[model samples]
Target: MPFTASANDFRVAPATVTEWKAVYGEVETVNIVPARARISGTVVDVRVTEGQEVRKGAVVASIEDEKLALQLRAAGARVAALNSQMTNAQTELTRAQDLLRTGATAQARVDAAKVQLDVLTSQLTAAVADKAVIEQSAREGDVLSPADGRVLTVPVTAGSVIMAGEPVARVASGRYYLRLSLPERHAAEISEGATVVIGGRSNAEQPRQGRIAKVYPEIQNGRVIADVEVSDIGNYFINERTLVSIPVGRRTILAVPPQAIRTVHGIDYVTLKSLQGTLEVAVVTGERVEIDGKEMIEVLTGLSAQDEVVTR
Candidate 1:
């Protein structure tokens, strides 16, 4: 006896079972804002060059202000003078009390001497405070770094005269982040501590991992903004306006070639052919995964590991 030839007679490739899920994401990039100087004067010294990493509070540049230095010196001299006068007054007061105890000075004289000592003491304190203010101003002449970062721009060279509050150098901090602009609809899905995949260029393999550190409260221009800090990205210093791709979420599901599945009567079906026969099996489809521009549909049901499906 010979068996009749049917659709099942044609051998079909076995469907490779795979789990997949819909992945929603957006393109992300690294953004940076340079820091500026708070005060300025003539650039006396440039401590850091371009691309030099600096620690927080490190002196990046120094400004020379002759007038400020002179003021500081004068204030220090005044303080020293006041301190000497205060010491003399204290000695005199001690002597006056001793003389009063020995009945060689009137009590009124001793009281007057005490009042003079107090006045001198107050003057000394005031002078010391004034000197501190002057010294602080002098220290401000040297521009210090606000945070740990690399010098991105040195707008002024040594001996360049700069006005007060003028920027001498621009610095990009060592800390880096991926700034993502997501659609307003997806804003609610993202929050601080969310996992993300960060990579340079969309097609790059082996992306670095990151986590959401901050999420903006309000939407701008129909987009919600967030920042992801790339953990363990190494010493690579990303500059402003560098484009990168970030994967916000991922999952797994059953997938098959889109061509292998067909729809009829508002139902998804795949032609399952086995050695026994060919049968139409209804299946619930899930998210589609695109690999090399070919689409694969996720299978939910009506298929088993032992069955084979033909892509027609």
Candidate 2:
């Protein structure tokens, strides 16, 4: 006959457990901008130093071209001279017309004077137009920033000569992002807007929240690449080629050893070992979680904390 047991016959221990699921994610990228010179000239001044913050369209430096300056001055003088000539031509043309009407001057002389006045007026207009072009070139002498960003490099000195379309400084714009790669199998599970956890060497416990922004179209080296956007990280100034980990999703359920659970009468059940005796408790099972290379079924119900269950 089976031995009889009392409530004190069996010992029980409380187990605090939580359910979790495994997921996969990938790393994303941030881009750095390199500012280039739009016009050619000597560097006049460097206003902002390296690592300094700058605003959009701010003048980072000035370029001086003596030739351009002389051209502008000559254009201005030519315009003034043409304007005086145009005034004198207009007055002479008016007097010639008055003399022709009074029969003091011949019509042919009047016609010639009118033609001369018209030619001088056209020259004056052309000179004024040329002066406007020179003034515009003078404005381009100052090197203005293309966008708001921090200065990364100022390659030219005040006297250094730079060619047109050459790069003057490099700037990194916008918030930094981490670029990472994930296995192709895991990439399919991640979608845009999915939340993830980022892990690094320094802050292991303190995880940063990130979201899936994009996934690459093609697979490379049996892996799919993606970009994750981190929020509220605040200008951490991450450099290129930084490694990071991302969490995709979470799972929660009651876990039990696979052997401890048995299928009977088409229902899942667990044998509970209480001090009084052994009682068979019916339960609902969820997705299996692998712990220490052992399979454990999630316990849905019919089990409480501190309950002793048989494990084979």
lDDT of 2: 0.68
Each model's lDDT comes to: 0.67, 0.68
User: lDDT by residue for model 1 over 1-312, one digit each (tens)?
Assistant: 011224433222233332221233343333233444555567888888887877777887888778877878888888888888878888888898999899998899778878988998888888888888877777787777776766777788888887777776666764566677777877666679866655544465466667778999989999888876776655554433434444444444445677778899899988867667777889998767653355666677776544567667
Candidate 2 backbone collisions, by pair: 7-275, 27-180, 28-178, 28-179, 28-227, 197-247, 254-299
Off by over 4 Å in 2: 1-31, 200-205, 238-243, 248-273, 276-312
Query: In candidate 2, where is summed lDDT lowest over 10 consecutive residues?
Result: 1-10
Model 2, position 299, has a per-residue lDDT of 71
Clashes of 1: 3
**True-structure RMSD, every candidate:** 9.4, 9.8
